[model samples]
Target chain A: MSERAQEGRTAEGPTAGEGRTAGGGHGTGGGPGRVLVAVYGVFALAAGARAAVQIARQFDEAPLAYTLSAFAAAVYLLLAVALGRGMRRLALVACGIELAGVLIVGTLSLVDPEAFPKATVWSGFGSGYVFIPLVLPVLGLYWLSRRR
Target chain B: MIGPLATGLIVFALVIALASLLTTALNKSMGTVLLVALGVLEIGLLVQAGFVVAALAAGEGPTDTATLIGYTAGTVVIPPVAAFWGVGERSRWGPAVIAVAGFAIPGMVGRMLQIWQGMG
Candidate 1:
């Protein structure tokens, strides 16, 4: 982790000057980063627990939807850990994956409702979560870019 | 659950949460008074939980036992977790965590009521 942090610092040397002018702090460990991490942690726990219970109870009902729930939960968990640990590379990768998942799943669910049969976290671009899933990845990406 | 009691508690929690949010927005440290208020809210939630359990024992129970238990457990867990994290930071974010937790409590309680009433 220290090595990665050093690499990030080196790669971001040029942007650091611009960042200071923009009121940016030390990477993704700043004040807004802390709050965002907390919120992500909350969603991770909530979505993971809900998916676990749903899959354990009735995996036979709609395997596709339940599996998607599990996938979304894993992504959330990974995003939370990446953000908390301040792993720039891992955070960027996870956030990108999250964005792709939400977009793909959202599109699939819309284009073919019968295939979904049930709603997952990313269904309709996370309508059930007040569209936070859609918005969070964008913020995550911007936060990462700012750190760079 | 008593409707009035639940509504009153929810309102109280909302007020507390909003106050906490304001303190954070002003970039102020979380003081002892806010901590005490959070303690009071936790105590109230515990009391409400006790009442809920008693009512269940007296045959006023929700249909889905597991979900109800989940909410009950979440209510007990959230406040302390928030307090622990909040105290650790000791910054404006500390009170912000409390604000989130406070808002969560009323939402959970409202869900519990809906579950009990078969509206969920």
Candidate 2:
């Protein structure tokens, strides 16, 4: 009987928390949106580190690609912060830029291979990064809309 | 960088990630099991980070020190931050966040191994 009661309390915990968070106007900073923010934060670190290393060590190797990586990193970092802070407008703008960036870069990388001697995060729809770069912004926008 | 440690951490991380996903799917919130598992993963990563840093200090490791160090830093930091963020949620998504960290740890560790091997 005690064990069953413990299990009941454990299961009841999350549902109550979820409702309070959703109704609290936390927007993009609550519930499943929290997961989205974490993913974005990880991507931000990954992209930023990649860009930092490339720019620091071999800027001359592929200036255009490296520069684009830096730009992508900035955007990701911005989106992560905006969403976490519940700044909808900034998050929306960041997501829009990210979606546009990946589609454009993914298409360009395939259509003009030589033009991109090196890969940016968005190359081939983020094929190089498991395509999370491709899917993340869409998820961000969707989660934001749903939360709103 | 001990080759076996990276491989072991990869295995451990994936297991934790899968378990976290299972918790989420079951509609369960974050529990002591996930936190303890994450703690174990964090300790393992810290051990690896110590070795890598020691190797670097001894004038060893890949020529691409910056990237390798970056990966090391990422691996060490991600878990605790995930725990902090996940714990605050008190929902199924809490475990989901931990799951993301679990998945990311292996990728970074694998990359760090590759870098240490001078492969990439």
**Isolated chain B TM-score per model:** 0.93, 0.98
- For all candidates in order, the CA lDDT equals 0.75, 0.86
Runs in model 1 with CA error above 4 Å?
A1-30, B54-60
Worst lDDT 10-window in candidate 2 chain A: A16-25
Chain B TM, cand. 2:
0.98
User: Please, what are the lDDT tens digits per residue for candidate 1 over residues A1-148?
Assistant: 3443344334333543454212334546434555566667667766776677678877888899988888888887787667656677988998999999999999999999988887898999999788988998999898788667
What C-alpha lDDT does candidate 1 achieve relative to the native structure? 0.75
State the lDDT of candidate 2 residue by residue for B1-120, as single tens digits.
Answer: 998889999999999999999998897879998999899999999999999999999999999999999999999999999998888776677899999999999899989988999998
Off by over 4 Å in 2: A1-25
- Residue A56 alpha-carbon offset, candidate 2, angstroms: 0.8
Give DockQ for candidates 1 onward, in order. Answer: 0.22, 0.50
Indicate the residue-level lDDT of A120 in model 1: 90
Docking class of 2: medium
